[model samples]
Target: MDEQGVRGSGSPPTGRFRRGAAWWRSGPPWVSRWGAEGGRDGGAAWPWPSTLLLTVFVLVGSSFAAHGQEGERAALDPFARVLLLVAAGLLLWRRRHPVAVLFGTSAAAATYLGAGYPYGPVFLTVAVACFSAVVAGHRRAAWAAVGALWAAHVLVAHWLYRWLPPTGDAAVSWGQEAVVLAWVVAIMAVAELARARREQWARDRAERAQAARRRADEERLRIARELHDVLAHSISVINVQAGVGLALLDSDPEQARTALTTIKAASKEALGEVRQVLDNLRAPGEAPRAPAPGLDRLPELVTQAAGAGLTVEVEGEPPRLPPGTDLAAFRIVQEALTNVVRHSGSRHARVRLDKAAGTAGDPRGAALRLCVDDDGPATGADAGGSGNGLAGMRERAAALGGTIEAGPRPDGGFRVLAVLPLDGATAKEGER
Candidate 1:
């Protein structure tokens, strides 16, 4: 087959085989797309290359052995040369049809020996075929083929020597059989080792692919959470201000203008934050280290809530927290107040921040606490939420080894309480 035909597709082998030795490794054009057999590891056109080298080695080595063993064995004739070629040629299909190729190589080698051709590198063809078969996940078939060849050799060398060529040849000694047995055992041992190594490499590659997929999934989830927090809180305020603006557009033009002004500010801030998040996605390494929203931005959220007509009460003081805990705290507060504005009948909500007393067996700076509350008969029975806001809040808290408790209070209101861990989360972030 020509180079293009054997390659199946591509510019042709270029680096090592620039001199066009491809024909030495390939057969007829009809079988060029060898890897399409659906059970091999190499490309569609590149079967085993070593098969050609083995052919050359066997032909040359057998010629030298023939002269040395001329007195004791059948001369290397044209027929013997044909057998050598047949054995080596069968190995070309070993990758795609390992079992079949092994069977063919073994039969040809056994026939060559049984015909009393001088033994030299003839057995090497069978050994190469068996090694390829075993490494291709066909160990049982390889062993069977090798065992069949050994059995045929025993039959010829011991009982059928008289009928074989080189008449008057005596039965081979038991020591020669022992040597053949050892040789066969060694071939199987090396092949088995190679098979194990291939399996291990495949497993390692699969594990690395799985790990890459897992990291991508995590990054996607984090970006979604950031977008949800930025949009939901900002959009909720815009929704409130737009409603106020429309209600007072005719009778109270100044109030309407004030509400529209708030809408513009809220939208501008939302777009800026959204752009920051997306810029990090598009060029994460080069994006500026703009500070992420944290409790430091808590007062800005309160100002936005006031414009939306939800009067927010503040208590206690925000702490200097680890970046993870700070961001989770900020998002949790923003989402809670957003829920109050969107779902509750009450226009008043309270937010409190405190350095929490750690849970049992934990250090003092181990947690920060946030609480948001609104007196409410909600707009509906399911006024809780129908979106990712609450779920995103819980995910953020849980990721930092923290907890969020958002439920109805006994005194007829909704309350969201979050306790975020400090020390462990900081350590984990540093490790990352």
Candidate 2:
């Protein structure tokens, strides 16, 4: 599932990093997704914020290099200024062409050093390029840039030491070379860390969004089952009673009055149950609640079905059940009887409950078995096989780590049998 939105951090990044982060996040969606792809050498690759930062680094380093040179000798020539500008400008496309950027920047920096220009951190541009390339997942190009630039440095140093005299306390030393190497390594490490952190954050966010979607789906299913049960059973009974009232209105006034009263009672009951289901949506602390139906309500259910002209027979002692199991049992029976009233041509149905002996690997030691059957047609819509009712029963039973079998029996009727564990071990499994 896609994340609906991102929650901002309570404590966000600060200082220069914060500013950069803001700019980075402000870009269009595609920019962020494309950031780690092939840079300058491929498509439109200038992630503007990063390019801007690189420009600033390059300009500052160039100025320092020029000033240091002038202090030691003379100001930078126009050619050196132009070369530095060109190198910095090329970094604008670094993301799309990282390898090329690394190579071009390394060449410019090397040329500036070789020609005896001011050496005041101008090499920082090449270091930044190498870091960008590595973090963009181009390891070979980054390492190659590092090795080539270091080689250029060695050659430039050798040339200067061999011919040019050391200038006014500015001679390069072994310690300075080690420090520069360390700076390159440090930049690489920081870039790698940033990339890892970013990827991990994206993964965590995706997982949270997926979990939220799954929870929403489950809640919808539960509400759907509630609505179906409350409406199907009660509305069905009321519908039947209303028809009887109309049939008796012309011949028997007292019988018609009784039919109307039955309708009134059924409607009121349905409205109450519907209200209860809706209240489930309220805030947990504010919503008044009631216990869900269980086997104890079976008698009332039978009476309701009888009023609808369906004869329902109940048998066997109701087994002790966990809340989830009990509610599921009641729903299974309720849905089955509703099917009988709506689809089964026959007016009679049987409901059976029994204790199922524990078998091997049965953790509950016993299970509660529920079976509802009707002497309806063996096939067609009247058979009760083609409806959401059976599917809901199966889902409920499966949620409790049990199973339901529903189909037309060989003896010319439809049957729905479910076995649910009563020990509560699997009751919570559905939530998970």
- Error in Å for residue 173 of model 2: 7.3
Model 1 C-alpha RMSD to native: 10.4
Give candidate 1 misplaced runs (Cα > 4 Å). 1-28, 32-45, 359-365, 381-386, 430-432
TM for every model, in the order presented, reads: 0.88, 0.74
Please report, as a residue range, the 10-residue window in candidate 1 with the lowest summed lDDT: 1-10
lDDT of 2 by residue, 1-432 (tens): 000000001022211222244545334444444442332234543466765676677667767766665666435778777767766766766666789999998888877766666776457667777777886778788878877888777765655545533354244677878887887788778878876887788899999999999889988888887787788788878878888999999999898998888888889988998898788777545645778889999999999999999999999988767777888899989988887787667789999999988877876668888888888662223232324666677778878878887766777677778888766645475555
What are the per-residue Cα lDDT tens digits for candidate 1 across 237-281? 898899899999999999999999999999999999999988898
Candidate 2 segments whose C-alpha is farther than 4 A from its true place:
1-104, 159-186, 282-288, 357-361, 378-386, 425-432
RMSD, every candidate, angstroms: 10.4, 9.4
Steric clash pairs (candidate 1):
none
Q: Count clashing residue pairs per candidate.
A: 0, 8
